[model samples]
Target: MAIEWPTTQLEKQSDDPMVILNPKTWSHYHSYGGWGKFFDGLRERKLLATRCSNSDCGEKRLWLPPRCECPDCWHETQWVEAPQTGRIYTWSVVKYPGELFKLPAGTPLISVEIEGVCTKLMSFLKEGTPEIGMAVKAVFNVDNPTNSILDLAWVPA
Candidate 1:
């Protein structure tokens, strides 16, 4: 039987965690605030970052991914929408395709380390080599009908 990928288009406003199951593949959750709200903003073609909330310890989060905790300083964080552009810290060509159903076969997922930040975020390299310290940015796929993580991706800046 062919694998099935369930798609849902709901505006989830609840704080409760949402679960997503796939019989053909691994399952994932809708995720909580650290990523959910930020991702939702991406649907509108915007990016956001998390910052430490501790008054004594002010830390800036990097590469606005779904999960984050203060690495240097353990502190609560807030959200900040970033510019749609950044630089690549490092990347690698996917010569051996593996398990992610969301990505196309043999596609390159570039790991970008945005400028002015100490962290690197992974994104699909639409064009060019897996160079370090190269410019890159988040490219949202709005045409996609599925409300999934694959909807948001990265490309050269």
Candidate 2:
């Protein structure tokens, strides 16, 4: 069997029949800086964070929603993998779902404290009622990662 390849050089064309795209696409973007590593971790199903990079900062552990600088010493931070397991720090039911995270009405949004991280990460509960300090684990939307933090949820561990 023979395979065929395009021979003609392609050029930018406003009316190319083969090229279709959203006519008025809308998108949101952010300059994530040090937190940029978080998305890379998402693609690999890992939870990453950052810790104080300056020795003078004296912060020996990682922090979630990774800070660009240390809160204590104001030093730059380094990326680290936070434990995917945690317990609910708190939760609230959203009556109206946001367009980005289209959860059912009354779906619980949880703040989880992953092991080894000093910050509480906000995510939706996969199911079941949430209780204070309820054990949970990070669940990645592997099939449909929206490239947003909303792609991560929590379920009973």
Candidate 3:
């Protein structure tokens, strides 16, 4: 089913419990700030990660969700190209997602474990079934970029 916004007034569903369906309509201005490069990389079909610039920092692994500062030393981070290939560490089918979820229900969500990355990147499977230890590659929605994390997906490699 397609998502539709309610244009009419709020509808009261119950009286004893007090429940109502309130229609909300508003525009929110948001900025990715230092993380804008991550979204831009998605459009360019590139996966960007962040690494601590401080030489003294103990953490040398790349961060998938690029950070503006290093968590260890609080130093500045540098952008680096991440490995496109990874293995599905875990997965589950989102049979009943929230209303704001753009994708349809039953979509397979996966946690990818890429080498050199310190953490698992959460993304959806674009095609094929997911399994533990399944090899996968990053696929970008460059043709129709959403400027969001949804623009990145994984497919069986």
Error of 3 at 112 (Å): 0.1
lDDT of 1 by residue, 1-157 (tens): 9977866645555546864442455576744655677667767886667766666765555545633556657665676666667776666667667665566666776666665545566667766555667777778876653555566666666
Determine which window of 10 residues in candidate 3 has minimal summed lDDT. 3-12
lDDT of 3 by residue, 34-129 (tens): 999999999988999999999999876799899989999999999999999999999999988998999989999999999999999999999999
How accurate locally is residue 16 in candidate 3, as Cα lDDT from 0 to 100? Answer: 82
Question: For model 2, how does the per-residue alpha-carbon lDDT over 1-157 read when each residue is reduced to its tens digit?
Answer: 9889876555545664565443545786777766777876887888888888787656556878877778888877887788888999999999877775566788898999877777788888997899999998887887878777876888898
Candidate 3: clashing pairs of residues: none
Please name the candidate that would achieve the greatest TM-score relative to the true structure: 3
Q: Go through the candidates in order and give the C-alpha RMSD of each one to the true structure.
A: 12.7, 9.3, 7.1
Scored by lDDT, the top model is 3
Error of 3 at 149 (Å): 0.5
TM-score of each: 0.65, 0.73, 0.88
The CA lDDT at 92 in model 2 is: 91
Ranking under TM-score, best-scoring first? 3, 2, 1
Better-scoring candidate (TM-score), 1 or 3: 3
